[model samples]
Target chain A: MGKWIELQAVPGARDRWVRAEPFGGTVSFRRPEMLVMVDHAFLGQRQPKSATASGRLDPAAPYEAHLTVGHRCTVGCPGCYIDAREDGPAELGFDEWQRVLDKLASLGVFHVALGAGESTPLAFLIDLAHYARGLGITPNLSTAGLHLTPRLAQKLGVFGRVHLSLDGAGRDHMRGRVGFASALMSLRILRAYHPRVGVNCVVTRASFPGLGRLFRMLKREGVVDVELLRFKPAGRGAELFAQMDLTTEQKRTVVQKVLQLARRYRMRPRLDCSFAPMVCAAGYDPTRLVRMGLAGCVGGSWLVAVDGRGCLSACSFDNTAGALSWSDLGRPGMMTPFTNWIDQAPSPCAECRWLQVCRGGCHVVARHLTGDFNAPDPGCPLVQAQA
Target chain B: MNRKAKTKGSVLSVRTGSNPNSSSLGVDVTWLLGGGVLVGLLTMVGQTLTRWALTRAKSKHGQMD
Candidate 1:
């Protein structure tokens, strides 16, 4: 092998690879698609270590961590959830992230996705990715690509996954007003550099209509992986929530369409943890869906996020008022305040049949709408029907 | 899951992922995407599943006989 990253499959340590059956042994992520015949396969892999077992907030630590490099964004989508602006704060520096990566590696975290309001300006983004990889943690990226140049794509050659943000197939749903042509060019350039490139579609009522066309557009570019992310109502310009939030019926429709399209196009699709309730509501076997990486409210469990200010939250959308800094909770044995976002779910969700699968839907969204972090996802039809 | 499986006493499996620099793009994932940092080409590299399991157990628990 000219160059390869070797990842040991430690129990409870999750990764992008299918660390379970239908794939094979969870140990050694030598290659994504390579096959190795072991003398005898381990009967089974260990489940993720929960607080009940370890009596610690994070038993094995989160398998994946997200790093928000900065908020300095040039493309100002009217309903931008992060409030990212051209002059937004650039709080975390290069050294701070390196230290953060060191902690995660020691804690057994194996995957990280780097997102920036705009990565083109951040010269160290690729180097940061390389640093995480050196620690056996695979690093991915999500960018607005408002100003992605061919030279920049070539520089990003080391990254295995680089998802470009797009609202829809064309001008009608594209955010950042980064016109349709500009978005297409960014996709082409990134695809040429890293063909495994994916698209992060911000799902809202406004963008859902053109989703079919968007899927087709991405497929034409040889893009095979896609993730449907909920359009969060946070940050500035959130006043547009009423116009953008998916309606009750629209939520189910979007989920249905996403699954249908995944099957039709032979695409590898992922729905954000917040979309778990809707996905389960469609009468599919949630356990079987595990093959597709479906899980509910992975925050405080399978994943966590660190922002530019060095704050760590259960999920990136978490805005629980007070903050948890890397200097504070980064230490082992400290409990993140986000624990209640999972352990103390709303009464309805706790009593709901899909409780374990959804973890009461999205705690951040519930807190944003109901002022109660334990409240069920406001968009959940299960809660609506019961109401 | 652009796969062609052959099972004996040992198990052999393949999913879909390719290098961006490679000219061959015949991979089609069955149920997963962006599996991991797969660096090997489509060429065969045969190894026993027992080694894979022991490596996993050793890594997960710090060392085992």
Candidate 2:
């Protein structure tokens, strides 16, 4: 067994040795003086020395935020997670969203994912992206591509990243009759100007079979980065959950296939944190899986979500977190209370083997499945097998 | 210096000798060749064992703490 040690300087000239043990490779370091240490292992497995040395984040700052700009969407897919409707909750006006952006910037959030209902005005999205850029926050836009006009695409050129949603080649059936064609046409147009366009594919049982073909199609289009969002039972998604959710066997197959395809095509595929358990189920080390950035569940900790109505959530799918308005920023703690609330692991999660990596899976998904946020994620094969 | 001179003289004598196929010298050469092969095998085995152990350790424990 290989042994390694890191000595961190603490207050009072004290040195703390963070030792990596031989048997379990467990790392232990405790020093109040250390502002941040990047040496974190996932599922009791140590990462590469470079990863451990470079992984640093300020404890007080959020790494990312998903900001919903509007509540109306045009691509009314049956499985839309937000249950976004034409007549859904009114979106925060441009001025209100600007205040939220300022608050996020003040909180030290570096990246903001701007998404809206499919029907959101393109003008609002462009203005908000520009505003976020002015605040020194790198904005990432997620869109259904229904309204991705030449003017809007040109305006969105300033975005750090743009995620165009596409499920499979069967766009008509997967995303709606018009969504697939429109998204593909927009992607073609955007590629002419934008260099960092990525595809966000929602992995569901119906879409799983066509993933390989879709990946090939994406690679042919010169797109190298694809983020696979796991299907969650939220909003309008719950209605189709029974038919769309992947079985354990299917989950294993899909994960293995995706991993193989990613390597074969030299594509960078990032799975949502909800798929961490699938990696564990595939008998792979979570640490290695995390090197692909697919293992850690950063919800409520590294990232937070704000709905169109100014409601704060641990993630876009998690709406249980209380309302966070512009007025809340005047308080001393601001969003700390909400961040802390969602960041705290439940008692049941302590016993999980993948606790360090998976962070007990998505709390919203757990609550949706078992009717308790504290319950282990029902999607996890380990949790399912236990049950 | 005397030992080296004596060994060189002995080798010259053997090369010029009538009985070139001496059993003693043949045995010594065979023993040296066999010893070399044995050492080579042992070195290979040692290297293989060390590699196996390291791989097993990594797979089981991931990394040392």
Candidate 3:
């Protein structure tokens, strides 16, 4: 019952959201939450072409899985969640790792993510990628890029997407904090293989002011896609308000700048807020890049993540967010936090103006920061202004 | 014609009413509703347990020292 929204653009830049005069709002499908609502209500509910003529998928479906090769890291960033769990064991066994992957395949998994640690062994990671490819699964790996050696990169070059952490320019800002240089070197090697390489830039107190420099460097490196991760205070990073919490107005300015930069480099920058459109939950829907997040969950069980100790979690940040644990992995029909959310997200979130669109802010983020899943979305400024 | 009639008679016998091929119709609506409530309660228990576990882990394993 909410208004339909769309993307409006400024001259020389790509279209953004602006209200259409008579319709009273924008007119683009960029807002999937709103678009999905419109398509179902106003437009007749027709089955998608991807589905069978009968309007459902066949019983036999394939799924993707996530494998956490090792849980060891060489660097300690100021706000990293992995660093908080440094006390855990080193890695998951090869066979146990395979079991996680096989489970994903059984569930129709198509995409797999590796790493929440410093280095997932070059040999084991390559083997996993090769294995995923053997099963026709796309393997995506994220790294601080600090420990990625030239030799290792050349060897494990075949991958779906290699996300390198490029926090900022110069050794001073990136060195001990987020390990950007090693990630750069790794990115260079990955480029030799010509796999799709994207940069994960964490916007924090230290790196927010360096966006201009960071994007320029990315352009020069021939990187086209960048994922901007907003800083959420979790784990050791939870004390960030004292150092780097952005005010509402500041975040708006930053979001606008990010959009401008996206146009400048002709590089697609996906915001966790924009791309995901909902709060992520751990362990409910097993068939998405994200299990429980609204839009970002790779529908069809695309993305899966496993940690070093052979623990299965929905997202890399799952441990910090506090959802289902490693212990719940093999149970037949265990009740996961995600399934409950799917069934019982509160009324305000379920029936809100943005519910169909935003998927009720990230629960993990909500729980960690505000202690409530029903709290106002941190992106309230953008969501409210649009409607 | 007699075989067709017998087949229809058997089909009609399976139905509660005399509608041949209608088959049996039963709704276990209570079980579905009951499962929903059970799931909700279990999730609350899980969250409370997880919070407690994380608090304990944070105190024990969640530090830089």
Model 1 chain A: ten consecutive residues of lowest lDDT: A50-59
lDDT of 3 by residue, A1-387 (tens): 113322112111122221111111111121121111111111112324443332111112212344556656556666665553445465666776666665654443434666555545567777877876665445667666655666777766556567776667665245354455566677787777655677666666566777878888889999876766666555456665346544555455664566567667766565554223322221122122111112432211112245566545544445532344344543443324532353365645555444433445455555566676445345444343443
For A1-387, candidate 2 gives per-residue lDDT tens digits of 222322122111112121221111111111110111122322224444444232322133444578777777666788888777878887788898988888876655545788888778867877887887776656677777786777678877767677777777764237653556677898887787686787777778877888888888889999876777677888888778778888777775766687677766767576666776665665654443332223345555556778888887656776554565543532445544323332465644566655665666665677787788666677877777776
Task: Write down the RMSD of candidate 3 (Cα, Å).
Answer: 20.3
Provide fnat values for all models in the order shown.
Answer: 0.16, 0.02, 0.00
Question: Any residue pairs clashing in model 2, and if so which?
Answer: A19-B65, A20-B64, A20-B65, A21-B65, A73-A117, A73-A118, A73-A119, A74-A118, A74-A119
Candidate that scores best on lDDT: 1
Query: Candidates' TM-scores?
Result: 0.77, 0.69, 0.61
Error of 2 at A186 (Å): 1.5
- Judging by DockQ, tell me the better candidate of 1 and 2: 1
- iRMSD of prediction 1: 10.6
Candidate 1 Cα deviation (angstroms), residue A12: 16
Best first by lDDT, ranked: 1, 2, 3
Docking class of 2: incorrect
Poorly placed runs, candidate 2 (over 4 Å): A1-58, A171-173, A286-295, A326-349, B1-65
lDDT (0-100) at residue A200 of candidate 3?
Answer: 68
**After aligning candidate 1 to the native by TM-score, how far in Å is the CA of A254 from where it should be?**
2.2
Winner of 2 and 3 under lDDT:
2
Prediction 2: B-chain TM-score: 0.44
Per residue, candidate 1 scores C-alpha lDDT tens digits across A1-387 of 313434344323433222332323323344542323221223233333421441222223565677777877777777766677777865778898899888777666656777777633645788998887777766667776767878888888667677877778876555766877888889898888875688777788877877788878878888877777776767763577677778888886666687578777777666676777787677655433432334577665557777777877776677652357865544543444455555566667777766655667766677777877667888887887778
